[model samples]
Target: MGKKTTHKFKAEVSQLLDILVHSLYTNKEIFLRELISNASDALEKARFKTQASGETDELAPEIRVTVDADAKTLTVTDTGVGMTRDELMRNIGTIAHSGTAELAKLAEQGKESLDSLIGRFGVGFYSVYMVADEVTVTTKSMDADARPIVWTSDGRTDYKLQELDEDRPHGTEITVSLKEDLASQFTNEAHLKHVVKTHSNFINFPIYVGGERVNTIQALWREPKFQIKAEQYAEFYKFLTFDSEDPFDTLHTSVDAPVQFNALMFIPRHGNDPFGLGRENRGLDLYVRRVLIEKQNKDLLPEYLGFIKGVVDTEDLPLNISRETLQDNLLMRKISSTLVKQVLDHLAKMAKDDADRYNEFWRAHGELFKAGYMDFLNKDKFAGLVRFNSSSLDDDKGLTSLADYIARAKEDQKEIYYAYGPSREALALSPHLEVFRRKHVEVLYLFEPIDEFVMDALREYEGCALVSAEHADMAKLDKFESMEKEDKPEPLSDEQKTELDKLLARMKDVLGDAVTEVKASTRLSESPVCLANPDGNVTSSMDKIMRVMSKDTSIPKKILEINPDHALIRNMLAILEKDENDPFIDQAANQLYESALLLEGYLTDPHALVGRVQDLLTKSSSWYVASGK
Candidate 1:
């Protein structure tokens, strides 16, 4: 051992240390990940240098981790190009090389922004302080003339460097003295192995724990698709997701166009945390040149893709001075945009190539796709990837793609129609869809509430407008029919219709603003009444979601459409002739309006509905008893 000289950290180094020790990272465990990543990077650098020099010797490229329980020390060794004495002083003693100086300047200037600093700095080295009290780095350069060097830092205010004459090999080794509280956990071989296996199993080089090789899983994202076998992919999925079941869908894509990237994404077989659980966080692991940058990085993918678990590797990322912050590099944004497009394209192709398999994926992740449609409303690329069950198709059948729906549209069809209800059966049986079904118009069945917003956002596909079947303009669809005017009978007599208008006005007064306008239904068949929204501003689905979010129970107003041909409508018209003053008749009409509102999924006062129904039932029972006796 050589004589050690103590030195104060640079002005900026002191500032960076203060920030890092205070609140730089949210999780302390991430310190291990950062150290492992640095080891991997060093190993990669050594391998590249060796390959360039065409030297093949005893120094093989690998990363080895050793835990010493008795000493309370953990060491990560890498067979890479070690630093010389001057290099050690520059790389370890000074924070300039790591870009910490730049960050300090930014902080001083009050221009601190994670977006610009992340990826440029190499602060990942300091994360060791979070768990360790002292760190020592021993390195021997590849040059035979260069002597070994040791750099030591207690992470307080100073560090030391000196020349050493130990019989060290040509590589780097980092030893950390575990903090007293964490010493026991670090001493456990099993615990250390588990952490290595969980976070660094796919590292390109082998990682050994307790003198035993631990990392056996291959980095499949780095391998060519043709070289990867199905079993290998399955195993990789199982490892990446930590799931026993196989993935429902897997997309492995590599592109160089907008940005160079490699991605291996999988849709889980089960929907464990769907519905957002609060707000969904991004689950994709981000990497730069096969080295892990962040696990479950929230910025790599959109929030709607939280269900997807995968790895994305790119070489063009701009890491901050500490390699801790991920700065907003244009390259990263380009890569992100390209990745989203590629996933959407892959889904579209899968739906076309194998409908059955794609249906399974849709069943598991369809809600996420719907969410993407709602949140990324302007992302038509993602919108085109959505699939839905259609009333036009058979039950227990495959989903309808947006492109397929467009291809099957009639030449004169001005809109792509859709209907939302609780389920496929409910939508198909809805009186709202009766007119479209009669005209042989295919209506897409939307069972989920979010689907309404999705359809609204994707208003037009292939130049055809997306029209909800319950929209008031659906009445205009009748004009598109080739039926002659003489074929269909007039709705009602002019005088009876005039009287009916007066009746609707009186009912609207009783119902207050709840009824926008009560009109004769042109869309209903078996159902006595239904509701329609003429002003497309707010759909029933939006109302439902808002009500749940606000926890408010106030009912929204809606227009009532009474089917003229239905038996209930005929009876009400007859009752108006002899019983204009009958309280039972008024109760029945009001109940019919309220029932229509309920069926349409509008907000309604349930207590008022119950009272009206009871009154009508009592009046009918009394009339029956009076006539019989």
Candidate 2:
């Protein structure tokens, strides 16, 4: 047996102890969590030792925490790997074995904080000082020949180690003399049990608080998916997110090669902040060795997936000396990458297996998912996941994927076409989609403002360039033979074409720089006049959004396209040829341009158009009276 010995803590350890006692850990309650976690680790080490040594004695590894209000004492005992007197002196009394000397140096340099040192410095035992005035540890090594040892400290610069007189089992017990204020609450069995279940309930080993088993729920994420029942998954999801409804999607991911992690993530059916009044704090609860370390850690998933809730446990995470926060951002990014891929794969599978379910999910979260459309690395994947109302669909209830669009495209279709408007119904009524419908070409209906940005980022999908329906280059697209339209207008004769060219020139001269050009349209069917981008540049939807963002007042110049087959345009041309300078003729042409601008969403002043309509109405009434008289 060794004699009683007392020693002063190393200089760095003394400073570290000061930080732990006064400033370390945000919540004082975390001390219990840390202690329990350390006990679980010790039990795990012991179990492995028993396995390796082939010990015959049955080892029922367990952690027991007892609170005694009468004595103002809180005891945490674990049936696990115990330490010898030398180990106690080295591990607890000095900074030589504990990994906190660098932390102390960091604290000295003002680069580290007490909050940052709690979980990271391998000093979980010292956390007792946060709530305790004194701490004593009675421990006996797993070696049958070793004697029991007792260590005592007032959480100051010095500690005492002495040989224990009584014989005990191969385990460790730490007794903390709680401070006066904390003793009352901590000694209550219910409060202690709550703390145990809150943080360490998922520990593999049994945890008994006040002689009642507390860790009832196993870490289901660590279990194989086939073994877990559907009801269990639903219950787990409810527990994790606190939402009564089942998750829209569940992604269980386990990776071993790049980095070891077991993650079970759930896509929430609805966002907590439906109105988005405040930024929702969302992320996975990070766990290491089945013990909760960080809750709501946003770094585990990207911003687009903020609605995901779950647990991520990894043994390979390179935690900073304080296990409170992740040490490496690169490692976090890798984890995020893996999680995102798994989520995307799950969504893709859902899209394939059940269209209705996928559509429901899209209705709820599609807008949020658009945020990832610009991610260059995952643009292709996002494109496949995106769904939009297509001209080919009979109703707006169903949305078509890009792959479906590509698959159904005509053999000669060189580009994918899309139209942007406030809604599917509005887009279907667009003049831009006139020739597309005539040629039996499908056009995607982009409703949200972000839809344009998404399409812009996804300029091409599956080798087909995405072309806006309102662009002038669609004249070539008009040549595609259509089986749907039977009442096609005949091609204009050379003389009619010549006359149409003259009318276009006259309208262009009247409109001046307000438009780039005026031409007979091969794209329009019912509308008399519509505006288009002659340069095949920004679509009207994108133009409106950019103008709003930059607060630029200038309207983008557009090409005026007049449907030659329409009666209004034919009558305007006949009247203009007879009297090009006629006031009514000029009013008619300018009004047509304004109407096109309005349809293109470029008109800021409808008051001018209203006044022109009134003038036209008065003229028509006067003409009717003159004819009647």
Candidate 3:
């Protein structure tokens, strides 16, 4: 062996390589991807040269990976534009030099084209050190007379280079002697083949592992949508998801202006159970020039759209800095914002073009989609896509979007009203909806756990504020213009009104701080009583939210509104007039308050309410016995 010259790696390179081998890459297997991607770039350069010069070489563009388990060595070879000794020293010896800059220089001489080159960050070749204890490279230039050269690195501080006497093929070959711990993983033929198929399966050049072709799946997103067929999309979706069912929606998007990218995304036939898989499991695969950089990369899309599965290939993305993470860069932000807009716009289109399909999607993924409702940048857009069961809807399965609700709203209505409950039946029976029903005003039924959060974040839709049905402000809403103007109930006689006021004071005294206020309510048309948060106090939804967050559980005081015209209240007045201290009246008053609390979903101790009801039942039984019935 000739005397090899030992040269130190660049200062920036040594530090960068240390980070890559120890910190930058989440998985050491990424070394294989980086090396293979570099090999693919060399092959692409070779193809471009041949095309530009109209000269052919005997070597076809191919990447071959061979693993020797016993020797604990992995080798990757590519038949592409090889480098001369000087070129090897300059390209691989130094770090952070743009490989594309060299190609650009060659283009100036009419010898190479920079358009097809895939690598810009020169440090990708150094990732081999992440898995390997040592790496060896052998290359000969595409020029027939060029001498072959060898470069070796231990990946720490220095690399060695030497010229070879023997003639070499026109390409580059890299051999990695993996560390003792990584031998079984990197040296096994099956494991190496799997890595190749996972990372470089869609590289334009064929990749062979263990003498078997591994990159069989084409990067279909790279193909124009016009040239692709429906069957092809179905086949690709099946291949991507492994689900037999067709995708609910497919968005094949390609953009070039802000940041170039091609995305083939699929809204699954069914939403992914993110909780089951861990939220981190949901994301799109990120690729650069058809080579997988990150698998299920969450940063590509917001968590709300995590149910979406697909591949996003962007040549403009600076994924070379770290195989483990794409830095939070402007380009990535641009891509993410663009992707979110595309998804929202696609959903909007689906809603407009086909109601049933959109409704089907909403039924399957509405909870997942609710995440976007809180995104202030697109709040209005997301508001138009929010779905709910409304009073006008026939059933729970029948959903109405905010836009539709607003469209069908009364001309004078200034707010969108919603009532929250555990189920549609429960919400339908809520006393808070009585006045709305009497006036024939629609009320959206919110049942999803996240529905409250969505409404809270989206305080308004269109030009109207979102108001809860239980809100005291509902009384101020414009009354139905066509509501029959029934004669107002005769004003209670002055003495009767005084008696009623005295009765309210007695009840308030009995309840103490439990009742914020006991007053007559016109909002109630059928129900005897209902609860409302004192104006400017925390709402019921806010109370529920605080409890869910493990915050204070103290019951918020509420105003107990009684329907003065109701028969129950009239009888209570007569009982109070005869005996203001009647024990039966006290029991009835407390029970009424508990019933209101139960309806409001604030009664935490149902056993106490049950006991109260039992006492009332016993009292009734004694009265019946006393009357000899």
Off by over 4 Å in 3: 1-26, 68-73, 96-121, 130-134, 152-168, 177-185, 274-278, 320-322, 472-478, 481-491, 606-629
**Local error of candidate 3 at residue 347 (angstroms):** 0.5
How accurate locally is residue 395 in candidate 2, as Cα lDDT from 0 to 100?
Answer: 80
| Candidate 3 local Cα displacement, residue 336, angstroms | 0.5
Lowest summed lDDT window (length 10), candidate 2: 271-280
Candidate 3 per-residue C-alpha lDDT over 496-586 given as tens digits, one digit per residue, 9 for 90 to 100: 7888898788879889999899988868767789888787445577677878799777777889888887778888878877887888778
Model 3 lDDT at residue 17 = 52
lDDT of 1 by residue, 488-564 (tens): 43567876686677666666666777778878877776687877665766666666777888997777667877777
What TM-score fits each model?
0.81, 0.91, 0.88
Candidate whose TM-score is highest: 2
Q: Which pairs of residues clash in candidate 3, taking residues 3 or more apart in a chain or in different chains?
A: none
lDDT order, best first, reads 2, 3, 1
Poorest 10 consecutive residues by lDDT, candidate 1: 109-118
lDDT of 2 by residue, 428-487 (tens): 778888777777888888888888988889999988899887773765775677656454
